[model samples]
Target: MLGYAAMNRTLREHDPPRRCNRDMRKKTWQRDGIERAAELTEQNFEDLYAILQWNLDHGIYLYRCSSTLVPWNSQFELRELPNYERIASLAESCGDLIEANGMRLTFHPSHWCKLASESTDTVERSVESVEHHGRWLDLLGLPRSPRYGINVHIGAHYGDKAATADRFCKVVDNLPPRARARLVVENDDKESLWSVSELVEEVADEVQIPVTFDYHHHSFSAREHSYREAFALARETWGDVRPVTHYSEPARLHGDFDARPQEHAEHVAAVPAWLRAESDVMIESHGKEESLLRIQT
Candidate 1:
């Protein structure tokens, strides 16, 4: 029930380190174009195949999807392009591989995807971001549920925590059914805002979005709850789907001199002793697959 993020660094069979292309530079969809988009889409799947094959061979069945798999996806308007379906078709193939291998897929949007921002424009943009993620899940033929979801954080409170939670729920209410069903909110690592308990009391209790717990985050903002107690509270939010949690060691906690306290370590420092039941973990580490390997061992 443990898996790493994209890019398995231990396997040299895949030549390039990562699959998503960020080489667009200053290219706009108008001039620098869909040509590179098409190329990267194809390249992504080819590289993805290798990663999937590696996972299947090694018995790792949980994987987090890269948000950048489709280049400029959220930034560009891509639906009208003639070859967009080709990209969708290829993505479907990748999804088929994932399903065939019994892997569970999840996506965490970039930090800027703030669903509860004070500004209406930012909230709308966040909605669009979630919708885009839902479309990809649709292309993959995945169900609209926490099983395959777009996990996001509650945005800045702008000085009013209660008002922010209300705004968060309003945005959730506005989301189309497809996007709404795919949403899961997580407790952040910072103490200024969300904790597992607060997310439940404020957001999940309001609109039914499942909570994704991060043990590392809990350590930072736990509110004195024991690991088992906090984990049990989080597990209750998932309802039907098995819970998925984020696990990582802080780099500074393990003797790294110059690292920040919240920065993820290259490998798992330690797992909580209370973790004995069945639940999936999306391993957040600098070391990728190599980190998961070490932790599992």
Candidate 2:
């Protein structure tokens, strides 16, 4: 019932106890506390904690959280993993750990609408889903942990892209300003009419939200614009609130079907230089861990 701002204020007021627990202290240097707690929790918690622990151990503090698999399919009843309590507990625990480690956690909601047509149930559920997750972060006193982000497609243009943008803006306007601020629009695959530029052009004048640049989507969409151009457009459009860009290998097309992921050697080669200049990049690869290793190597 509380809007995101009030929820955040509540979380801040009820901040978790700061002193490290006996377990945290013992495992602090070993990076085993997160894993140990994860084993006691569910998969979502485990995954989140593992990522946090990995980042802490390696000193790569800046990272974001995404719920791509939380509500993995159209039937919202089925979650990727069943135990909600465990997931909630794990999230809370991870928040404490994150704070102790002096790191932040941001989130991205599932692309549920992308897989199905938009319906009242879909939109309402999506909104509810984000609020629910935000609460979990709040309960964990992590509402502000990663700074809460929900990335989404611009949706179909229907007959008019401007109308679609207006519709989305209205939808966004109704949300709690804190949540609205956290909501970011990502560039979609070629099938959609609303491109990143179009969405920005529509909302830039109205809201203070950022753009999420999906580089692979741009390549697959064949927008013919260079990465620099896209990046600059995002910067120009959003100003200080720059979009969080996604980088992944371009998918191959085989006839009407899309092929498995293919390596873009050139793209990979170019990332390091770009990354050096940028503050954040989310690797959206099927083989993300491997790709990160390759990038480092």
Per-candidate TM equals 0.92, 0.66
Tens digits of per-residue lDDT for model 2, 117-231: 3467777876766654555456456543224456667656667766667767777777764466566677777645555566567865566566667766676443556767766
TM-score of 1: 0.92
Cα RMSD to the true fold for all candidates: 2.1, 11.7
- The segments of candidate 2 whose C-alpha lies over 4 angstroms from its true place after superposition are 1-43, 62-90, 99-104, 114-118, 143-147, 220-225, 236-243, 251-272
Compared with the true structure, what per-residue lDDT tens digits does model 1 show for residues 1-297? 778786677654445564543335544556767777667766675666667777878878888877766776656665754577776777777788887776887888889989889777887778888888788788777778888878999946779999899989998999987789989999888788788998988998889988888888888778888777788888888999988888888888778969978899888865665552547888899888888777675
Error of 2 at 27 (Å): 39
For residue 230, what is the lDDT in candidate 2?
Answer: 69
> What is the lDDT, from 0 to 100, of the residue 12 in candidate 2?
22
The numbered model that scores best in TM-score is 1
Model 2 — which ten-residue stretch has the worst lDDT?
1-10
Off by over 4 Å in 1: 11-13, 16-18, 21-23, 28-30, 75-79
